[model samples]
Target: MTYRGRFAPTPSGDLHRGSLLTAVASYLDARQADGAWHLRIDDIDPPREVPGAADRIQQQLAAHALHWDGSVQYQSQRHDAYAAAVDMLLASGHAFYCALSRRQLADLGGRHPGPAVAVSPASHSATNTNPNPNTDCAIRLAVPDTPICFTDRLQGRQCLSLGEADGAFVIRRRDKLYAYQLACALDDADQGMTHILRGADLMDSTLRQVHVLDCLGRTRPDYGHLPVLTDSDGNKLSKSAGAAALSPDTSANLYGALRLLALDPPADLAGAPCAEQLAWAIPQWQPARLNNTLTFGVADAP
Candidate 1:
């Protein structure tokens, strides 16, 4: 099968070192395999999205010569697709609407919802035939109790029971917005992503996505997670954590990013043109050599 990879970024913040590292790793992994690399801007959460962050992300990628295969994809415009997915899950009994609020769930010990909490559509229709406008209901996927397992190329074997890890997760919020897990899983499959290379922080999310794909009878993608970057304080280097945005000097920082991926660029390649640097690094790409740890500090940067 032809390998297809992607770098998806939320438009909440600018591309920082950590985000760039994942993008580079994904880009090289696809290019090394002679596969197509795609770019997706995850602009689903409009309230949290920055006004200019999406365009800035594309510019940054271009500045580093990370041009994508085709035009960019935005999640916001795919609402109809997500809605159809939700409808399919509901009709197939793979998902149900729950009237229980978070506080109520907490009061009930925060475990997976039983029949009482998982309101059946038939019961809902009978009880509120007209459907109260004030009623709050969120759509949640029904996950099996069995463990979901997948081996990561870098992180090795992994398994998790969705029941224990995250109960029946919401696919659509009460406020009428599709959840991240739902959108991500459907988008990856819809885009024909054969391989996924992202930060390790989303490993748990992989399980959820796998279950989603299984529920839809869609094939799951091969997943590989790269180590997450952290600051000196050991906190994740993320926009929410106030991590500094990457400088505009792409060539200067491209060398350091390569080193962070465990690629040893020749001394002469330092500050070289981005294309030249990438050409030298692609053939030498060895994902197994990447650090298996979940997190690495910026102090490790070259």
Candidate 2:
């Protein structure tokens, strides 16, 4: 199969140092393999997306010369596709509606560590009067009671016991938005993405996605979850923490992000033009140079 990779961004804010690293890693890997690199803007959750953030993200990525191939894809425009997939799964008996309340799951002796959220197979409630899946009512994949395992391209062989982590999980939401596990699998398959480059924070989600793909009878793609960039205080650079947005005028932030991921860019990069620096850095991308740890703090950067 052709090597196809992608940099999927959720436009909740501008690209942060951490996000740039992810974009850089994916971009370089695709280029190195002479593969296609696609861009997908995950804007399905409009309620969470920030105003003008998507446009600003595109502008910043262009400024840094992290160009992508083909037309950009926006998830909001693909709701019908997600709906169709959900319907197919429902009809095929590979998925079913779940009605577990947050409070009940929360009290499940404690939150399950991995991705699968356990719901009793015998515990489902679908009334004729309220047939619509609730945002709280999610579609859970009916994964076989087996071990979900994969060899991480960067971290090596790994395994997650579905029964231990999270049991079957939500594929569709009560709120009508398709769940991430479901939507991502369908989108990746449709986009012909064979290599997935994302952050280690999503490791748990990977097992969940793999489980969902298995149930849907789809191919599981190769994955490389890079080290997560953390804040000065050691918290991961998440939107909730307001990671500093990328500035078109500065490659310092972007370079710092690469460093945080342990990419040893050329020494002259600090003064080189952003385009020149990126041109030099892309081919030098090395996934093995990065530590297998889940997170990286600013202090960790050289």
Q: Which candidate number would show the highest TM-score if scored against the true structure?
A: 1
The stretch of ten residues in a row with the least summed lDDT in candidate 1 is: 124-133
* Residues 1-302 of candidate 2: C-alpha lDDT, one tens digit per residue: 78899988998988877888889889888988889999999887777899998888888888877888998998888899888888888788777776565655566643332223434433442222332443345676665566789888887777887665655566776677777777787888888889999998888888888876776678889998888877778788877688777665667766776666566776778766677777776677777886466777677764
Write candidate 1's Cα lDDT for 1-302 as tens digits.
Answer: 99999999999889999999999999999999999999999988888898999999999999999989998999999999999999899899888777766655675567654333543333422132332324677778988878999999889999998887658888898889899999999999999999999999999999899999999999999999999998878888888777788988898778989998889898899879999999998899999887467877878976
Candidate 1 Cα lDDT to native:
0.86
Task: Report the C-alpha displacement of residue 160, candidate 1, in angstroms.
Answer: 0.9
State each model's CA lDDT, in order. 0.86, 0.76
What's the lDDT for residue 148 in model 2? Answer: 88
| Cα misplacement distance, residue 103 of candidate 1 (Å) | 0.8
lDDT top scorer? 1
**Pairs clashing within candidate 2:** 116-166, 116-167, 133-174, 134-137, 134-174, 135-174, 135-175, 139-171
